[model samples]
Target: MDQPVYSAAAPRILIVDSSRNNLAVLARRLGAEGYRVMVAETATTALGELQRVPVDLLIADLALPLMSGTELTRVVRRELAWRDLPVILISGRSEADGVVRALAAGADDVVVKPFHFEVLTARIARLLERSTRVRQLAADNATLDERVVRRAIELGEARDRLKALEAELGRVG
Candidate 1:
């Protein structure tokens, strides 16, 4: 009998861009590079996509149709606090204020338009790696918390039994 082996799925990237060309090109390129790509032309649709499927990373255009990527990042950061999703905002503008605002709004990284695909890919990898580390740390913390609680409960039970034993000895003597 042969045992079944499970393989990891490719990382899923959700890209929100109002431009059809941007969405199409990125989906094609990223998919070719072995990433499962999901594209949305608007932030609202991007939110819907998030609800429908689990995404590893988000690459959003700064200038979306109904909502800007900054706004979208804020909403995702707030509403999906448990998910801790990594967000990258790509924009045509290079102003320092715009970059600062996006970061303040919870974007993990920002990429300027006409970016090299290699650089974008590197950023995605870094963000995903960081996110993975964070999740691992959180899981470790939860396990530690459970162990502490279990130990405390055991200590309490032992103390209770000790008291009962003392009472029995007192009555016997």
Candidate 2:
């Protein structure tokens, strides 16, 4: 299938799945969609990769060798830097309890096995868009704060000058 082309600077995605076949399929699909894909067989390896490089999104399988996807999501959310990172948990089990647990663990979305590629891509796009909006809002807030601080300092200086002029007038009069 022909995938839509992204910009030269494609968003990076980290995929964690113990199954080699699953890794291959997802890597091919995401890459075709103009994403820079990185693969890890376990949650531990995924964490190590995360430390070395920044990723825009994480797609993890529910079942892993050492650490499960839910645990990985929890750890990612706990880290202040990665708290806003988008996480999508994929699993064959479609049980209600598992879905609840995944959400509680900070997964932004969940997908069941045999899911359509279109649906997965759509979900990914939504999450990325939301993340971008949040980052922009934060940057705007920071700029506004700096401006407020600068204005306050200027006001203080003006007040000091007014006081000095009043004292000089009293002495001259």
On lDDT, the candidate that comes out on top is: 2
Q: Which stretches of candidate 2 lie over 4 Å from their true place?
A: 1-7
Root-mean-square deviation (CA) per prediction: 4.9, 1.9
Return the lDDT, model 1, position 101.
94
Q: What is the clash count of model 2?
A: 0
Candidates in order have lDDT scores of: 0.89, 0.94
Candidate 2, residue 102: how far the Cα is off, in Å: 0.7
**TM-score of each prediction:** 0.92, 0.92
| Candidate 2 local lDDT, 1-173, one digit each (tens) | 67657776788999999999999999999999899999999999999999999999999998887899999999999999899999999988788898899999999999998899999999999999999999899999999999999999999999999999999999999
**Candidate 2, pairs of clashing residues:** none
